[model samples]
Target: MIETVVFDVGETITRDDRYWAAWADWLEIPRHTLSALVGAVVARGQDNAEALRLARPGIDVAAEYHAREAAGRGERLDESDLYEDVRPALTELRGMGVRVVIAGNQTTIAGDLLRGLSLPADLIATSGEWGVAKPQPAFFERVLEVAQAAPARTLYVGDHPANDVFPAKAAGLRTAHLRRGPWGHLWADTPEVVASADWQVDSLTQLVEVVEDARRSSGS
Candidate 1:
């Protein structure tokens, strides 16, 4: 049975509109241009940060991030940023005795903001705080550590195939690829995603059904 659900923050439990819009505003570029560049980067299987570099060549992304913070404009998160289905799905999973964890490649500030929102999750963690990011075995190791469950019993859910599905599968965690965001929809039917993801879903609510079905099949 799936005893724990570890989630990726962006485009899974939360919508990333404000996050990218903030970056575009900080860069003084049209939001559409940055969005297109980000899509291009994702299509090319490059790091998403490469989009910012494309916008401003030779730019130090980390430095610019700090600069944005110094100017009183940094990563922002609140209830509005969360996907509507997140709370219901998490609450249902927790009610069913499943541990719900929110872990993703995000900044410590984003983690703090998420905590401030008081999401219905057992834990909320970020890459900045953990010093490891997605597609890293160590990162999945951390996830399994916090999950306190066997890798096979823990489900890692996200929207990115390469960063979320492939590595989590490599780490022996069952994965669910949610086809909600750009990266998700773009690669939803690709052979790699189809082969790697244990379950493919369109929403968090659907994930609840996945767990229920697994429990039923496992006689848990």
Candidate 2:
């Protein structure tokens, strides 16, 4: 019946990639290099904290990069506008009787970022707060438990295939892959990757309609 809709914060609900660009600019490294470093750390089976430790060089550079980028961009870097369509989208879903929630990997700084963007604080569920990250089945399980929703009745929308689509599908929840912007590179270009998802949409505005179709097909 799609009673609950869970979202990822960073790239899904918020424009965090710009921050990644800021990080890349600060570190004076190509964004792809930092991404590769992060992927290598994860491939080694290290948790987020350990991965952060292993990727400290890239992380440190990214931090400095963001500081300088923020300084240089000034008002242009303001993310307040990012939340413009987000709230309206959620409101539309909520009006359809869907329970909106967030399941994301974020640190404490995420709170300030959400507040600055005027996102509703109560809608968030972060790894920093829950002590777990995505690509782990337990993370989705925990969010389902908190939302009091059954796997079949929930939908998870995210950007990454491994972290977002695969895990959510593994947990038995329908997944919507948001493939907007340059983040499209995160998906595998094979048929298997293409066939894994229940739905794929290029924009968040398309999500509500997808869910509606799922509901109708399920005869809910």
Candidate 3:
């Protein structure tokens, strides 16, 4: 039986356009420019961090990120950052005795911010804490450990196909692709990626259904 549902943070639960547009506005960069930079990096199958380095050459991206984060320790993500479907779906899953958790490639404060928002996730884990990111085997190992759920019985849901669907499937978890974020829509037409996921959801309403369908189809 599937005992746990692990969700991606940024795009899976949070709305990307709002999140990134605000980020672009703060950095004094045009939203289209920022989006293109992100697309350029992802198009070549590179990590999201590469976008910043490419956008502003010769800058110490990591250092700048840390400095900004350190200065913004008090910053809280606006409620609007979250998708409307997130809470209701999480609530229903938890009510059904499924362990709902959040795990993502994110900064250290992702846990604090998520918790502070009073999100329904029972636990939140991050790449910062693990010192590793998704699409990496070590990260999935940590996810399995922290979740204390077997890979075969865990449902891993995320918006990015490269980092989420493929990797989670390789890690032996049931994979579900959420098709609402930047990466989600960007790679939607990629046949191999679409075919790889055990489930594809346009929204969390569909995501809830995917989980139930997985149980029935897999007989787990």
Candidate 2 lDDT, tens digit per residue, 1-220?
A: 6888888876677765465554555456788766666556545534433434444534563464356646774113245536355777787888888888877877545644565665542466678778888878889879788767888888888877777878888899888877743343446454644787777877677878977887898897
Best model per lDDT: 1
TM-score on alpha carbons, each prediction: 0.98, 0.73, 0.89
Quantify all predictions' global Cα lDDT against the true fold.
Answer: 0.94, 0.68, 0.80
Please write out the lDDT profile of model 3 over residues 1-220, one tens digit for every residue: 6788999998888766755565566566888998898888877878877777776778686676566567763335768889999999999888777898899987787667777789888898789877999889888888888777899889899989878899899999988888876688888768877788877778776756766776788786
lDDT of 1 by residue, 1-220 (tens): 9999999999998898998899999999999999999999999989999999999999999999999999999888888999999999999999999999999999999899999998899999999999999889999999999999999999999999988999999999999999988899999999989999999999898988999999999998
Model 1 stretches astray by more than 4 angstroms: none
Better structure of 1 and 2 per lDDT: 1
RMSD each, Å: 0.7, 5.2, 2.2
Ranking by TM-score: 1, 3, 2
Candidates 2 and 3 compared by TM-score, better number: 3
The CA-based lDDT of model 3 is what? 0.80
Question: Which window of 10 residues has the lowest lDDT sum in candidate 3?
Answer: 67-76
User: Which stretches in model 3 have alpha-carbon errors above 4 Å?
Assistant: 22-27, 70-75, 218-220
| Best first by lDDT, ranked | 1, 3, 2
Among these predicted structures, which one has the highest TM-score?
Answer: 1
Q: How close to the true structure is residue 90 of candidate 2, measured as C-alpha lDDT?
A: 80
